[model samples]
Target: MASSNTTLAEASNITTMAGRSNSTEAASPYSFHFGMLLNPDYLLVEAQVIFSALSIIWLGAHASLRRPPSAAHAKPKNGKKKVKDVQFAEGFTASDAIMLPVTAAIVLVGLYYALEWFKDPDIVNRVLRIYLSTVSIASLGAAAGHGLDIITSLVFPGLWVDRKGTLYRVDSDHQHQVKVGEGDVETEVVEIKTPFPSFLSTLPLSHGKIQAAWEIRNLLTEEWTVRLAAHGLGLAEFSIKLNTLLGFLIAISTTIAYNTTKWFFLPNLLGSAACYSSFSLMSPTSFSIGSAILVGLFFYDIIMVFYTPYMITVAKKIDAPIKLVFNTGRGVSMLGLGDIVVPGMLMAMALRFDLHQFYHKQMKLEPIDLVSELATATPGETVMVSETQYRRVKPTYADPEGQWGNRFWTTKLGSLSPVSIATSVRAATAFPKPYFYASMLGYFAGMLVTLTMLLVFNHGQPALLYLVPGVTGSLWLTALARGELKDMYGYTEDGSMDVEDVIVEVDSTGKTIEAVKSTAEEKGETKDNKTGKEAVARTEKGEGDYDVFLFSVTAPRRRAPKRD
Candidate 1:
C-alpha cells in the first residue's frame, strides 16, 4: 500500500513539471516551430545582396556604353533646325552635397513625429501608396525597356540593323544628285525630285515599305527615312515599337499582379526595378561629386540609425516598395533603397572612368582644318580663315558593321558552336575595371559585416556606415596603388574642358559643303557664354587682310551638365 502511494506521488510530480515546461515555452518570445528553425533564411538574404549588386553593376556598365548627349540631335522641322538634348536629372552640386544630410534629418524627424502623433501607420501608408504606385509604374516601365534591350542584344543580335540618314529642313521641294549607271560604264549625274529634303537609301535592301497614309500637318513635319527593322506598330502619333510595347505590357501586368496579390516577391521585383530606374535617371557627373555625396550620407546614416529611433521606426512602419524586405524565421530583415542607390551612383561613375581611360589609351585624335568665310566692312566680299582642331577616331563598339555580333561571339572554343555563355562571360570580364571590381568587392564585404552585426546585436544597423567606407576606401586605395590619382582627379563629365562647338555642313557624298561661324559682335556677347565669366577679345589682321578675333579668357567652374 505504501509503495503504490509513492508511485502515484512520483507521477503527479512528473505531470506538474511537464505542465510548467509547456507554459514557459508558450510565454517565451523566441519560441518557434521546428520547421521555422530549419528555414533557409540565410540563402534568401544572400540572394537579396546578389540581386542588388548585379542590378547596380548592369546599370553602371550600360551607363558607360551610352554616347554623349550632344551627339544625338532632333531632326529639323518646318524650315528650322535647333540643337536640343534631353537631361533627365541635374548632376549633384557641392551645395546639394552639403544640404543632403540636413534635408534627410528634417524629413526623418517629421516622419517620426507624424507617426507618433497618429499612433497608426495606416493613414500614412494609404497616402504613400497612391504616390508610390504612380511612380512605380513609370520606373518599372523604363526598367522593362532596359531589360528588353539587353535580352534582344544577347539573343537576337542578327535581327538588329544599323541605318544611317541625314536630317534636313523642308522649306520646299527637295532634289538629290545621284549617279545612275551599271558598274564601270561611266556613271552620269542624275537629279531625283522628292517631296522630302533628305532620304537614306541602302541599295537592294527593303525589309518593309513606308506608307504615308495620313499626315498630321505640323506634327508630321519632320521625316526619317532610316530603315530600322524594329519600327512602330500603330498610328503615327501614338505609335510604339514592338519591343517597347511588349516591355510596357510586361510592366503593367507585373504591377497589377503586385497590387492584387501583395506577395513578397512582387515587392522585391518592383524595388529592384525602382533602383535600376534611379541609376538610369540620375548621375554624380564626376568622381569628386560622387565621393562627396557618399561621405555626407555616411554620417547621416550613422546618426539616424544609432542616435535616434526614427530610422528603424520609419522603415518598419512604411508599407511601400522603397525597401527590400526578407522574411527570416525570427522576424524580417529590411534593406532601404537609399542603401543601394547612394553608393551605386559612385560605383557607376567609376565604371565610366574606366571606359574613359580605355578610350584615351586606345584612340588617337586626328587634326582637321575648319575653314569659314568672314565678311569684311566692305559688302559683297568675304575672306576665308582656317582653324585647326582635332577629332577622336571612333571606338570599335561605335562601329555599326557587325560589331554588335562580334561583341558576343569573339572567342570560339574548339569545336563548340557560339553559345550564350560567351555573352555573359564577355559582358562581365571584357572591361578592365580595377576600381569597379574593388568597389564591388568592398560592397560585398560590407554587406557581410552588416549582416553579422545585425545577428550579433539583434538590432537594426546602419548599412552605409560600413558600405561607404568599403566602396570609397577601396576605390581611393586602388587609385593610389595604381598611381592614377592625377588621372582620377582630372577625369570629369563636365564639358568645360571639351572642345568648342563648331557647326559644319556636309553633303551626302561625305564632302564638307559649308561651315558656319557666329561672330561675337553679331551675337552681342562680351562674356563667355558657357561659363558666365569675363572675356576679352582682340582682333588681328590675318593673311589677305582678313580680321581674326582671338579670345583669351579664363573658363569658370560651371555646373556640370546632366545626361542619361
Candidate 2:
C-alpha cells in the first residue's frame, strides 16, 4: 500500500521543461498521472470519498423519510390483528450474486471471441456496422422522445391504462410482519378507489392532436388515394402523396445526416439521452445480479482494454454508433455505451428507489421490510424464514446515521476460531430504500475514478473495476462504520409486488405492454405473454380505447399502490 501511494504521488508531478529535458526521462513508464493544478489522482480519490460521504447523508434523510408509519415496536390491543406492511422487492441473495456474473462472463466471452473469428469477413462487418449504426440512431431518437411519450400518455388519455386503477397494496401476499397480540387481523377485503381529473377539459387539444394526425394518415390510404385516382385527379393524389412522404423522407435524411458526421458532438449528445433512459428504467431486484455483472465486467474490461488492445481495436474498427464520440478539433475521443449504461443502471435504480421512497412519504406509509418475519435473529442461530433459510440470524439494527447497517459476521474461525474471526465477513446488504441514494453517489464517484484512470493510463480502463468499489465501498464502509453492516448486507426484494400497469417498450424485452394487437371483428380475443394468457381488450372499454391502451390487461394481482 505504501509503495502504491508513493507511485501515485510520484505520478502527480507535472511534466515540466526541466523534467522533460532531464537525462533520466528515458526510464519513466508514464508522462504523468495528473500533473494538472489539482492533481487528478488525488482529485479522483477525493471524489470517491466525498461523493460516498454525500450518499451517506442522503441515506440518512431517505431512511428518516421511510421510517415505518407505525413504530416497529408499537403495541397492539387484545383484539387487534396483525398489521401487514407492504412488501416491495428484495435485495440480491448470495447465490444469485454469484450466478448472474458467471452467466454474463460466458456471454461476454462468446461476443468478444465471435467478433475475432469473424474479423476477416469484410463484407459482413460492413453490413453489421451499417445496421448497428441505424439501430443506434433510432434508439437515440426514441430515447429523445421517451420523455415526450410519458407526457403524451398523460394528455392523450388512451395512451396508458391503469388496469389496477391506481390501487394500493396496503398488504401483499408477501406479508410484512407487524406483531400481533393474539387474534388475526381483520382480513375483510379493503377496497380503495382514487379518482383524479386527468380529464379532457384539462388539455382540450390533446384529442384534436390525435384526431388531426389520424386524419392526415388516412388521407394517403386506399380510401382517399383511390377516390382521387379514379376521378382522374392526378394532381390532388400527387400532392397528398408528396405531403405524406415528406415527413418520412426527412426522418431518414436526418438519420443519415447524423451518421455522416462520423461521430461529432450531436451523436454523443443524442446517444447519451437514449443511454440515460435505458439505464434509469432497469431496477435491480438482486444485488447479486448487479454485483455479478459489475465484477465480471470489471476483469473483462481490464483484460480486453489493457492486457491486450482488443477493445481499442474493436472500437476503432467497428465504425458503428455503439459509443459516444466527440470531435476535439485535433481528433475524436470516445466513451463506449457500456461505460455510460452500466453505471447508469445503478444510477437509474437510485432514481427509481427515490421515487419509490417519495411514494411512501406521499402516501404517509412505512417502507415495507420483507424480512420482518425473521425480525428476531441471533448471530449464531440458523433460522428458516419463508422458503429461504438464513444460515446466521443476527440482531437487527441500523448504522449510527440511522441507515441500514451491515450485520454479517463469520461463524467459523480456522486461524479463525468459531465465532471469533478476525476478518470481516463480506455479505450482501439491502435496505428498504433511501439507502439506494448512497449507491448513486458512489456511482458518480466511480465514474470520476474511471475518467481519472483514462487520463492516467492514456488508454481504456474497465469502468466497473473502479465503479464496483466506488459504489459498494461507500455502501459497505458507511454501513460497516455505523456497525450496521449486517442489516445493510442482507436485503431482499419481493418483485412480485412490482408496478404492473406501466407502459412497455415494444422494442425492448420488458414485460410492460407496448401495444396489444387484435382484430376488432374477433370476439373475446386475448394475448398470451410471459405472464400468461391475458385479455387483449376489456369488453366494456371496447375497440376504440383498446387501440390506445398501452398497458397489459391480466388477471387482477397485487401492485404497489400509487398516489395522485
Candidate 3:
C-alpha cells in the first residue's frame, strides 16, 4: 500500500511540473533562455542611457548649426567664393549616391563572412558574450559620427550638386536659387530679367507658352525619373533603406561579438554607461537598447512623414507650390501608421504569448466601451493632478450623442463612421479596386511570410523584424508605394487643385513644376493654346485624393527666366 501511494505522488508531481512549463511557454514571447538571460533591470537602465545620449546629440547639433562654422568644412567669408565652393560641394559628385548602396552591400556581405564563427552554437551561446564588452564602445563612436554628419550638413546648408553640375543655396529669407557655377568666373548679373508673368503674358494663341514651359517641365520630369532610378524616391526613402542596412549591420556585429567571446558584459557595461551618462539628463528611457535600433525606427518615421516633404518644399519653395503640412500629415497617417502597425501588432503578440492575440484583441475590443472621462479644468486655466501639472485647458465638448470623443465610437460604428464611409465610397466610385485589392493582398501575404519565417527559425519575436527589409521588408515597400499614390498629391480638403497640391522640382539652375496649360503651351508641349491642359480630375469631398506622378527624365530642370 505504501509503495502504491509513492508511485501516485510521483505521478502527480510530474503532471504539476508539466503544466507550469506549458503555461510559461505560452506566456513568453521569446525562448525561455532569452527570458532568463535578459535582465529587465538592465533594459531599464539601457533605455535611460540611450535617451540621454540622443538628447545630447540633438542639443549639440542645434548649437553647432546656429553658430558660425569654425570647422574645416565651414563656408568661405567672401560671398562669391563661398557660393562657388558651396556649389562644388553640394553638387552631386560621382561617388556620393553610388557609394551609399555599394558600401551598404559590401558591409553586409563582409559582416556575413566575419560572423561565420557564430555558426558554431557553442561560441555563439556561451563564449561570445565576453567579446561584446570591447566592441560595444564603438556605439559612442557611431553617435559621434552621426552627430558630426548632421552638424556638417547644417553648417553648410543648400550645397547641392545637380546632374547638370549646378550648386543651389537657401538664403536667410528661404528663397532657393543657383548660387554657384563650374568655376569662380562671375557672369554679368542681370538685376532685371524677363519676368515669368511677362513671359506668360507674351504667349501666342495656338500653343500659348507650352514651348517655353516645356524647357523647364522636361527637366523637372527627368530629375524625378532619375531619382527613382536610384531605387528610392526621395531622401526619406533613402533614409529608410540606409537605416535598414544599419540595423542589419548592428545585428551582424553583435551576433559576431557574442559568438567570438564569452564575456560580453564588459561592452554592455561600457555601452550602458555611455548611453546613460550622455542621455540621462534629458533623453527618454527608450533610446539605449542599441545605437541603431531605437533611433533608426524613430528617425525613419520622422524622415518619411515630416523631413522628406519639408525638403521638397524647400527645394521648390519659390516657383512651384506644394503643401508641406498636408503632405506631411498624409504621410504620417498612412505610411507611418502602416509601418508602425506591424511592429505594434508584434509587440501585442509578444505580450499575449501568441501572435494571434493581436487579431483576437482587435475583435474583442470591437464592442467594448472605450471611455475616457476628464474632469473640468480649474479657473486659472491650469490642470493639476496628483503628480503632474498642465497649462492647456481640456475641452468639455463631446460628440453629438453626448458621449466622449473617444476612438471607441469609431470602432463601434465600424464601416458607418466617416473614415470607413470615405473608404467605401472611394472603393465604390474612385480608387481602382484591383489595385487596392492587390496591395492589401500583398501586405497580408508579406506579414504572413514574415511570421512564418520567424516561427520556423524559433528565434526572437517576429514582429520586430516585420518592418525590416528582408522578406517582411518587401511587404511594407509595396504598401508604402501604393499608399503614397492613394493618399498624397491630390486636392485640398475642399476638393480643389490649390497651390498646396503641386509637386515641386529643383535642380542646379532653379525650381519648376509640371507645366500648367498656360505654361505648357509656351513650353511647346501642348500645341493647342485655346484649350487648357487637362489636370487629373478628383472625386467628391469624401473620396481620397492622391497624385503619384512618374517623371520621364534623368535630371532636374528649372525655368530659364523667372516669371513675373
The better-scoring model by TM-score among 2 and 3 is 2
Residue-level lDDT of model 1, residues 4-47, one tens digit each, is 11110001000000011133433555332334223365546545
Instruction: Provide the RMSD of all predictions against the true structure, rounded to 1 decimal.
Output: 17.4, 20.1, 28.6
Best-to-worst TM-score order:
1, 2, 3
**Which candidate do you rate higher for TM-score, 1 or 3?**
1
Q: Where does candidate 2 have its weakest 10-residue lDDT segment? A: 9-18
Query: By lDDT, is 1 or 3 better?
Result: 1
**The CA-based lDDT of model 1 is what?**
0.53
Which wins on lDDT, candidate 2 or candidate 3? 2
Q: What is the lDDT of residue 361 in candidate 2?
A: 31
Q: What is the lDDT of residue 116 in candidate 2?
A: 78
Highest TM-score model number: 1
Show where candidate 1 strays beyond 4 Å: 1-40, 60-64, 68-88, 159-240, 365-406, 409-429, 500-564
Can you write out model 3's per-residue Cα lDDT over 95-149, one digit (the tens) per residue?
A: 4234433443343334334345355433432332345334443543444434443
- Our tally of clashes for model 1 stands at 0
In what order do the candidates fall by lDDT, top score first? 1, 2, 3
lDDT of 2 at 22: 23
Task: Itemize residue pairs with steric clashes in candidate 1.
Answer: none
